[model samples]
Target: MYGVFPYNNVMATTVSRTSQKTARIDIRLTSEQRELIERAAALTGSTLTQWTAQQLMEAAQRDIETRARLALESEAFDAFQAALEEPLPDEAQQLLARSPQWA
Candidate 1:
């Protein structure tokens, strides 16, 4: 089933190393997609597995960092800071004066 792509030109860039790899991930792709990735890997002197793993890791890190950050414009940031500096309303102050009723 994997006959169409030429695999002879790909080379492993890194020296032989061993690690405890206990997890497995399975994915399905079209032959064209596989061939494209294989070509890219060969050009970068990386094994297909290594190139794919690195790409996945970089993409995941970017996604996580983007989600974790809160970006605000300068005017909005000033408004937010001003709100924090304001005192609580009278009703809120009264609520804080009461003792907690624990069951």
Candidate 2:
């Protein structure tokens, strides 16, 4: 497993690495930024690399999950459902009847 560490006295888990293959990513940061990150890593009892990777992975997962979901209030959902059930306008129906140009 890569980038696993103890945070707040609790162990963090990650997927097991099945092979020795690895890749590297590099970034430049100001000294102030580095210090802040180093301080956070120290508090979590993780090395800078482990802490940075863990945070990046968690943030990436959160972003992906957010993008994958849709939420609507009950009234809004009902309106959306009604719109889908409504028949297409004559112009739209005529368009649908034609063979697609791309096809």
Q: Which run of 10 residues does model 2 get worst, by summed lDDT?
A: 8-17
Each model's TM-score?
0.68, 0.64
Candidate 1 TM-score over all chains jointly: 0.68
On lDDT, the leading prediction is 2
List pairs with backbone clashes in candidate 1.
none
Residue-wise C-alpha lDDT for candidate 2, range 20-51, written one tens digit per residue: 33888899999999999999999999999999
lDDT, candidate 1, 40-74, per-residue tens: 99999999998998899999999999999998999
- Measured over all alpha carbons after superposition, the RMSD of each candidate to the real structure, in angstroms, is 12.0, 9.0
